[model samples]
Target: MAGNTDPLSPRAKLAVTAGRAAAAASRAVGRGSGSVIGGKVALRLDPDLLARLATHLDVVLVSATNGKTTTTRLIAEALRASGPVVSNALGANMPAGITSALAGGSDAKYGVIEVDEKYLSTVARDVTPKAIALLNLSRDQLDRAAETRMLAEKWREGLAGSKALVVANADDPLIVWAASSSANVVWVAAGQEWKDDAWSCPSCGGVMQRPGDDWFCGECGFRRPTPSWALSGDHVLDPHGSAWPIKLQLPGRANKANATTSAAVAAAFGVPPQIALERMYSVQAVAGRYDVVSFMQRELRLLLAKNPAGWLETFSLIDPPPTPVILSVNARGADGTDTSWLWDVDYTRLAGHPIFVIGDRKLDLAVRLEVAGLDFQVCEDVDEAVRQAPPGRIEVIANYTAFQDLRRRVGN
Candidate 1:
């Protein structure tokens, strides 16, 4: 049996076959990566395809404004303790991407899905995930996504009907509100380093109280649930109050939080804590989030900064000794067409650091850097910019498309 369920229905097999043919044709023509379009066709042919394919899989669906890609990667690795897993590892979190992942394989007993914040409810409803992980929600793709709380409300409404166990970040008040009524929950105090969007109660519209690890709303009685797994310093503590240090190859406290959250989801699936932690320790990068790529003999660490909150956390990942850093921005639809969010970031933190701005919106970044009193040179090309920087360990941070383009330039 594949994935603990019966074989795909005749309808599902036909849809998957057509989708695969379409994907192969698209790739043959040298079009863009055909992962999405293939799934789109398959889903169009079989409206109930995701549900049908996920029939017997122990599915874990992860959703968040940021870190969903990396977190999903981590969870997939951890589920290796269970069996083979199917997942959308290329950062496509929509239905098509998810359908494509499942369509490729029949041997995978588990499906780890990274769902976009806006598409979480739709996918979760169809997949009927065994565990729904609610990571932090914040401002992202403002032009594409609804307001932060509105998205949370949609999650709350969707989850109310789902019988899946909820694995959630207890530190994010917005996340707490979204998962407060889940039928079964494993609350984790994964630590929210960015709290710009979580200031009020989703139920009563009353300002919430944040006095350290615990937060409670006086008006609506909304409060931070006691955590089952909590992050204390660099370690993740389990339900029995046993703590283990996560030795992840990926740097930064943000990744630490992500690993801890993934571990909690693993526990919900009965995975031993050590097995889950061990698998996560080996993940060096998730779709170039913490990849160290080479460009002219320099080990340039690539990190994604897709939004203001993400930028704030990404800045912390950089060493403070003042090494040369490349900043790239693109205003493509994938990277959020509205580049105005550049002003929303604290570019001032970049002051006194050697900054080389590149990408389609390099000039826009240069203007922001200038206003922040940060010295930066506009480099039209990332590789050329890397060549000009002084020889040392390098950190190159970029938004969505810019990160992808540079990864290709660096030979992937």
Candidate 2:
């Protein structure tokens, strides 16, 4: 048998197959614990993985409470206009997922990965990016993220020793503070303004008054400097009561921030503003984040609500309550280990009767809706709720896991 051996091509194929199977098995075993989020599993790897990947190409990291996925996708798309770029298109933001993306795209010239707030420190320490885009910080995942300030501090410490160019949202107080402390920083400001709950002076804990379009601390006199790249001079045409423009492809004020941030990052990479604007106009919404799909002769607007800030931003974008709203909430560990944050959401803005609710944890959402003095019907089946909802103007609010299930069931 040894004398008859030749190139051994069959054995080589078998070895590759076995290696893939082992990796898949390891991922499955790792997911048995409670560390991973979304469908991606987290696993430890040798430090050489990052070193090997870093030698392949430059990396860009985008992180924020909201708009990270959209901005990351946009930046990746814009970068591809020049050359090949690799990204975590499935909304993976943890260290394991980042490693998986990099390992999978060893040949790509550029890598763009969105990092979650809680995991930014870990990612920053592991992956030394060429540039880091730090979007605004907001109250999110209260259980997982102790507080916005704590996350900010972790981020500051994570990037303190790195040589990455920092692109920050200057309008955000938290980001402004981080930018001021960083030696190499580019500030990007969005023209649109809203009264956020957490915009205050980081140094003195005083109210940061908006003097004109810019924000300044009334007590301490600290203020954000004018951005190097700013999006201004356009009014959001709100034909409906919502503060969103009717002309936008994505229907929300939050999307404006995403668009402007994307433009800024693209411009930083030397893409012209006109090209960025055109790209923004042509961009499509990712699945489950303000994704509007047509099914059964009606439009199903699926918005993913993860935390109180996200819910508030989404609620502010919805047009005046259409008749018969369909709201779904799931308490599955995949969606969220705890559903107590539902209490912080203001469901009273849902101005209609008999709101249809569906999910494994419909009772919890129903209880919250009841406490808010809203009428709702508890349906365990999402398909049933989708079918039973009236034909006129349907808005489906789903948490992370339920959004995917709802999309699959609704054929969108």
Candidate 3:
């Protein structure tokens, strides 16, 4: 009797329970094994499940500190020029989230996944993608990612035995170093045309200098070689200072990196460079990243700020001051549990003072501004902040969770 009623039975009750749960989850995800809601549910159940699914499909994995979502989406769109594709439209980068994305599109011929830095190595091992694109690595989410070196090491470990074609950013030292270690690699660089900041060498802790737009280590002599695929041309018009004329719908230098990276990945896959550029020009705003919207007779630029690197890049793109800035901070599970990252952003660069601060953590942002010796108006309600802000050129910066909330508040 005791054996018959065992809750931890080897194959009977446990198998039944597991089967039922899976079936319910499948049903919840909807037909064809795909649904945003369903994918999210699957992730909640198991994080490594996506890697298991990758073995059955053609996968293309993209990882980076910034621009992973836009770059992943752009890659998917470029591939779509040839055939059907599947991807996580919401920028879910974890193992389980990737599985959720796959489960949603069981019929797709190709899979495009944006992998989080922390999980890239694990996912790469499990998925064994056909090709992997390593975009630039920047300092972001210090609480979760700790340091960029840690992420670089993990990527090296995960991609050790991968036979997949490697697409690397020649402009970035970390990417150049990673590609050097790989056997099958195609290097892509943004050319010496644009001016941007490059990080220090990961090996000797020396400054990695850029001879052109391409980088080299001053002390270690670990410079990146010339890229096989390069974005060349003089005075390549960056209309919005975000790398333009290639047809970028977003604003900021980060967006340009995303576009260039997408073009490189597409070219590696044999997509014509001209065709890729055409598609890039045809694309529109991607919701949160530098998306412009109309609100209350004012033009609102909604930019997502998830970490220090992203915020710094966004701030750098802002046109010279006099443009009012409205920043919103929230404690959404997605923006991370810690709100201390706000202190890392250089708020003084806004030209003058922040016109308004909103969201649940208004005071928190206000305190940060004060510590920086910058003046700001704090509003407990997002709507009040939007209502009170002067109508004209305005910049609205928000985290992942607060983007939509502020969007709705501003009637975007």
**Which scores better on lDDT, 1 or 2?**
1
Off by over 4 Å in 1: 1-6
Which stretches of candidate 2 lie above 4 Å from their native place? Answer: 1-45, 191-200, 210-213, 233-248, 294-298
Query: What is the full ranking by TM-score, best candidate first?
Result: 1, 2, 3
Better of 1 and 3 by lDDT: 1
Q: What is the lDDT of candidate 1?
A: 0.86
Model 3: per-residue lDDT, tens digit, 76-163?
Answer: 8887776678898677677645766765554566789998878777777887888898887766654566466766766776667779
* Each prediction's RMSD to truth: 1.6, 7.4, 7.8
Number of the top TM-score candidate: 1
lDDT of 1 by residue, 118-184 (tens): 8888998888899988889988777777899999998888888689999999889888888976878
* Residue 129 CA displacement from its true place in model 3, Å: 0.9
Candidate 3 ranges beyond 4 A from true positions: 1-52, 191-200, 207-214, 232-245, 295-298, 337-340, 371-373, 408-412
Model 2 root mean square deviation, Cα atoms: 7.4
lDDT for model 3: 0.68
lDDT of 2 by residue, 286-351 (tens): 755767778766777788877676777777766565556677777665555678878878788885
What is the lDDT of every predicted structure here? 0.86, 0.67, 0.68
lDDT-sorted candidate list, best first = 1, 3, 2
